[model samples]
Target: MTMTKIAFFDAHSYDRDSFEMWNKDFGFDIHYYKERLSMNSIELTKGKEIVCVFVNDEISAQVIDALVKNGVKLVALRCAGFNNVDLPEAKGKLRVVRVPAYSPHAVAEYAVTLMLSLNRKVYRSTQRTREGNFRLSGLLGFDMYGKTAGIVGMGRIAKVLVNILKGFGMNILAYDKFPDMKWAKENGVKMVDLPELYANSDVISLHCPLTHETLHMIDKDAIDMMKPGVMIINTGRGKLIRTEDLIQGLRSHKVGSAGLDVYEEEAKFFYEDHSDRMINDDHLALLLMMPNVIVTSHQAFFTREALQNIATTTLQNCKDFLDGKELVNEVMAK
Candidate 1:
């Protein structure tokens, strides 16, 4: 049997550590590149059979074509999301697989953490205490119990989040194209329409994928339908909510608070230290200044367990493809 040569893009210290640790088992000829996968970076994959990418990499049609020209057979996404990849272009050109369910608990717990932190003013409290000013006047927070929490998706992560919210005595209102009636019946979760979820929920969290229909789903019109002073949380794709619309919502007090782990144009800002340089994104800068908003740099799935799962699953996907085995996690455009 011949060995598989893999080219990994968007390589970071943690990503390298995890992949290197797992690669010892398979012993494939792997090369890591710190640059993200794009049309310009296609030359790096010359003669490589598999190209591994992360969430921030650009896997557009041009990139896919370039990869095919470079003899790349498989595109292994280390993350669960394949929105960055052009599925239609790669459907017959090259195989694509992803780590669909790395650690739902990691993301679900982080979502709840963001909600609690935003609700209880944990960020403000930490800042105040650090400055030696212990004040509780502005830190008043309501109880999570009995509050209606709307979840926009009902996938693995959303189910985990629903279970966590249930533990807190919070009511669950979920919306999914294909409703899991059995699971909802057992968990006492009500499957509702988008408008109902918007008008009724006190706290709204987004877990849907970024598709043409779902893009900017939480726009100005959607925000208008939501309850006033509603808290919005997004750990899903950033493009789901229009940043300008969200900013306007914040100004009008339509959105009481936001806990975001991702941004629409986060590729340049996230996973890098830019403190020494000036922030060019005015919208993002304004969000950082807002007291009610909490922005994390897409770190919800950064736990050790999730990283391990991602690395193992990604490598196994490549191995399976090379061995002519079934690609269980393969993703294609419908």
Candidate 2:
């Protein structure tokens, strides 16, 4: 029996712990690297048959060329989003598989958590109470029950969020390229066009994938269409919202508040601790200075259950590829 050797790039302690725990049962020889996968780091996969990557790994055309040269047969992604990988370039050369659904509840719950925190001024109240300044001067919040929520995508994660929001007695309006009318009718969600959703929703949340059509979808025009003082929450890919346009909206008070777990240029700053260094990204720095904006380091999908599921699914994908089984999780270019 030939043992399959896999190289996991951009690996962290949590990744190691979860993957290694499952590897004991799979009996695969896996090597872990702390550095992210890029053209410069391609040599790390010298003799490996499979290379595993995360959300931030760079799998461009150049990187794909190097992977082909390095005898890599498969690329395993531990996360759902695969915009970073060049699918067109890797079509005939190598196969790509990803964990499509790890834990939708983790992300959906976090989205609501951000909405509640921002709406109720939880963060500000915590800070104020810590300093013994318990005064309810500016901590007023409106009722979420009477407002309308527009969801961009109605996939598994979005469905979970829609259910939760429906429990709060909020009206639901959703838009998707391929709309599921049956699901919407069953869940009491109204299917609407983007313009309608934007114009009527008091709170908008993004759950769409980042693609050619959806990239920078929330620009100045979209912001202009939204209700004034509307709250925005994003746990999806960063490029979905244009940072410059968001900044412009914030400046003019067109967007009242924002809760973001991802940013467009977050590759250099998201997963690392940069408390000691001065942030060099001017746009990110400017967003950080705004009190109405809350920026997290893309941690919505970091729950233990999600990590364990990701490890299990990723390993299952590797096993399926090696055993010549069907790749249900394979992502192909559209």
Candidate 3:
């Protein structure tokens, strides 16, 4: 039996160990990289049949074309988001498959955790307490028992969020292009218009993919429509929020507090250690300066369950495609 040759460009330090642990049965010639996948990576993947990628990888037209030219047939993504890949260019050029439905509970729980941390100001208080100051003067947190939570998308993760928030006794208001009427009725979630969701929700969480229409969807106009002191949480793609406008909203108290796991310019910063160097993205720097903002380096999907699931699914996607079966999680261009 000929072992498959698969190259994982932009593979994280954590990925190799986890993948090896899960797929021990496979006869794979696995190649790893510490840096990001770019046009320069073309030469590295010259003889490989498949290339596995992650969130921050550059899957541009040129890169995809080069991969196809170099005998690479499959693009297997370990993560759910595919905005980095140029799908139109990849259409018919490469068979792209992603781990679409990993642990939704991981992301949904992270979103709520951010909301609670911001409401109680835990990040600030924890820092102060570590320095021998045990003051609790400004740590007043409201009960989320009756507040309405507006979910912007109704994907699997958002559905899990609705169920979790229900246990907190919170009302649910959701807006989606194709509303989940049955789920809404079963879960007591009201499928409302976008404007209504903005005006009514006490906390708003973003859970959709990034697209041209959704890029900066939380801009000035959307912010203006939102209720004052509304808490914002995003565990989805970072490009959905306009970072500059979000900063302004925080400044004006239009947004009371924010819990963000992703950022617009995070590709350069996340998965890298830059504590010794100057931070380049001014918006990210400024965001760190704010006392009310809570930012995590995109670790919402980093649970042990999620990681194992991701690695298993990604490897299976490659093996399944090579076996001439239909894709289990294929990304088709609409």
Which stretches in model 2 have alpha-carbon errors above 4 Å?
none
**TM-score of predicted structure 1:** 0.99
How do the residues 27-64 of candidate 1 rate in per-residue lDDT, one tens digit apiece?
Answer: 89889999999887889999999999999999999999
RMSD of each: 0.9, 0.9, 1.0
Clash count list over all predictions = 0, 0, 0
lDDT, candidate 1, at 31 = 90
The TM-score between candidate 2 and the true structure equals 0.98
Q: 2 or 3: which has the higher lDDT?
A: 2
Estimate, for each residue in 1-334, the C-alpha lDDT of model 3 and write its tens digit: 7678888877776898888887786667888977677987678888899889889999999998999999999999998999999999999889999999889999999998998899888888999989999988878889999999999999999999999999999999998988879988988999999899999999999999998889999999999999999999999999999999999999999999888999999998997889999898899998888888998999999899999899899888888898899897999679
lDDT of 1: 0.95
Ten residues in sequence with the least summed lDDT for candidate 3 = 20-29
Question: Model 2, range 1-334, lDDT digits (tens) per residue?
Answer: 7689999998889999999999887988999998899988888999999999998999999999999999999999999999999999999999999999999999999999989988898888998999999999878888999799999999999999999999999999999999999999999999999999999998999999999999999999999999999899999999999999999999998998899999999999988889999999999999999878899999999899999999999999999999999999999887
Which of the two candidates, 1 or 3, achieves a greater lDDT against the reference? 1
